[model samples]
Target chain A: IDAVCTAHGLSVAEFHALRARATEAKTRAYCPYSNFRVGAALLARAGEGEGESGGRYVLGANVENASYPVTTCAERVALGTAVVEGLHSGNGRGFRAIAVSTDAEGPASPCGMCRQFIREFCELSMPILMFDKNDTFIVMTLGELLPLSFGPDNMGVKDPAKP
Target chain B: IDAVCTAHGLSVAEFHALRARATEAKTRAYCPYSNFRVGAALLARAGEGEGESGGRYVLGANVENASYPVTTCAERVALGTAVVEGLHSGNGRGFRAIAVSTDAEGPASPCGMCRQFIREFCELSMPILMFDKNDTFIVMTLGELLPLSFGPDNMGVKDPAKP
Candidate 1:
């Protein structure tokens, strides 16, 4: 765990906090339709001049609609809220890491759509932590999860919000 | 137009309002990635005591993320907002009609994901109106857009929010 923390530039305490917060966020899920609850926690990259421990956490739980496709996943809900709050690629403020929690026996990663969503604002090397019901976890980078992903540059259109 | 209004049980004024609202909503789109703006309007079903003309309109515009797949389509946005506002199947207040507007030469329909999303809260016979750049239009039923779709009942889990 120490080696993993060092490699990802995350302290052991931060890692534990992410897992705990993600698990707690799961209780807030509004998934009456699927009975599948998911929670996500994001570690925002600290602004310049802020020390290594400056990163703040943002959390979200899945909000499902009767229309299955309208269901916003936990990761997306977190990202969307963050974006609305001025933490997004367009604003040049991006996330450092993300953690997701689910009740499955094994660690469950974000879905295909969520992987695509994360691709937009996170660096390729950003760590993604997946926690299972027993608190066991698996970690991977955003690039590895969604290889050959599409992003802002692929469109060849300048972000209107950017200079 | 009169033929369509009669066939769909919508008054001519309602149809016109949908077109105007959807077109106006397109101006609020935040799509910097694809540069393909889209807007949507929903006509909600009135309550039991409310008259046919009591239906209210809801609007939404596409919001794109740097990651292409994270982008929420206009139709899904309208539906999500409607659900959040308590106009959903679980509350017995579903929508009666939906309209979409885009700048394409011909009318543009909702994407596959949005189609699936719509299937969840709308009846099979619900009408979906599509408007082109010139305001020329085409209309189809939700059933025609997404045939043999999977929905809340497919999982055989009774909606916990429903009786």
Candidate 2:
């Protein structure tokens, strides 16, 4: 755990917070159809002038609609909320890490759609932590999860928020 | 236009409103990435005890992110907003019709993902209206857009909002 934190520039405390908060966020899920609750926690990257440890956290739970495709996943909900709050990618205001929690017996990673969504704001090296019901976790980088992913740059779209 | 309205059970005024509102909603799009704005309007189905004319309209525009996959389509945005406003499927609170507007030269259909999402709350027979920049339009039923779809019932999940 210590080695993992050092490699990702996250302190032991932050890692613990990600797990606790993600688990807590699961209870707020609005999934009555699948009953598969999912929660996500995003740690912001410290902005300029702020110290390395100054990042904050944002949390979200899955919001499901009767129309299955209308559902917003936990990761997306968190990212969307963060974007609305002005913590967008580029301009040195991006995300550092993301943690997800689910009740499955094994650690569950973000879905294909979510992986693509995360690629929009996070760097390829960003760490993704997935926790199972028993709190067991596995970590992977965003680039590994969604290899050869398409993004804004692929379409020649500049980050509108970047100076 | 009158023939289209008669076939769809929409009043002429409603049809005009759909075109105007969808076009207006396109201006509210947050799509900095695509720079391709899209908007949607949904007309609700009158609930039980309410007359056929009691249905209301909801509007949404595409919300994009630095991550292309994280962007919410205009159709899903409108549906999600409607679901949060207490309009859902299987409880007599379903939708009557949907209209989409894009600045493309020709009328554009909803993407495959949006089609799947619409299938969740709308009846297969529900009409989807697509309008191009010139106001020329085409209409197709949800079933025609997404044939042989998978839904809550296919997974044995009853509508939680159903009485």
Considering every candidate listed, which one attains the maximal DockQ?
A: 1
Q: Residue B98 of model 1: what lDDT?
A: 95
Across B13-119, the per-residue lDDT of candidate 1 in tens digits comes to: 99999999999888767677678989899998776666766578878777787665568878876765555445665434678899999999999999988887777
Restricted to chain B, the TM-score per model reads 0.92, 0.91
Name the candidate that leads on lDDT. Answer: 2
**In candidate 2, residue B7 scores what lDDT?**
81
lDDT for model 1, on a 0 to 1 scale?
Answer: 0.79
How big is the positional error of residue B21 in model 2, measured in Å on the Cα after superposition? 1.6
Residue ranges of candidate 2 with Cα displaced over 4 Å: A1-33, A38-71, A74-156, A161-163, B32-34, B46-54, B65-67, B89-91, B159-163
Each prediction's total of clashing residue pairs, residues at least 3 apart in sequence or on different chains, is 0, 2
TM-score of each: 0.60, 0.60
**Candidate 2, B1-163: lDDT as tens digits:** 8988888878899898888888887876767667898988899877778886768887877778655556888887677556544566534777878999999999999998888777766778788999999999998898889988767677676643333
In the range A62-161, model 1's lDDT, one tens digit per residue, is 7676566568888876665555444554333568789999999999999999888777667788899999999988999988999987776777755332
Candidate 1: TM-score? 0.60
In candidate 2, what are the lDDT values of residues A1-163, reduced to their tens digit?
A: 7888988888899999999989987876768778899988998877777786658787877767556666888887677556544566544778878999999999999998888877776788889999999999999999889888777777777643334
Lowest summed-lDDT stretch of 10 residues in model 2 chain A? A82-91
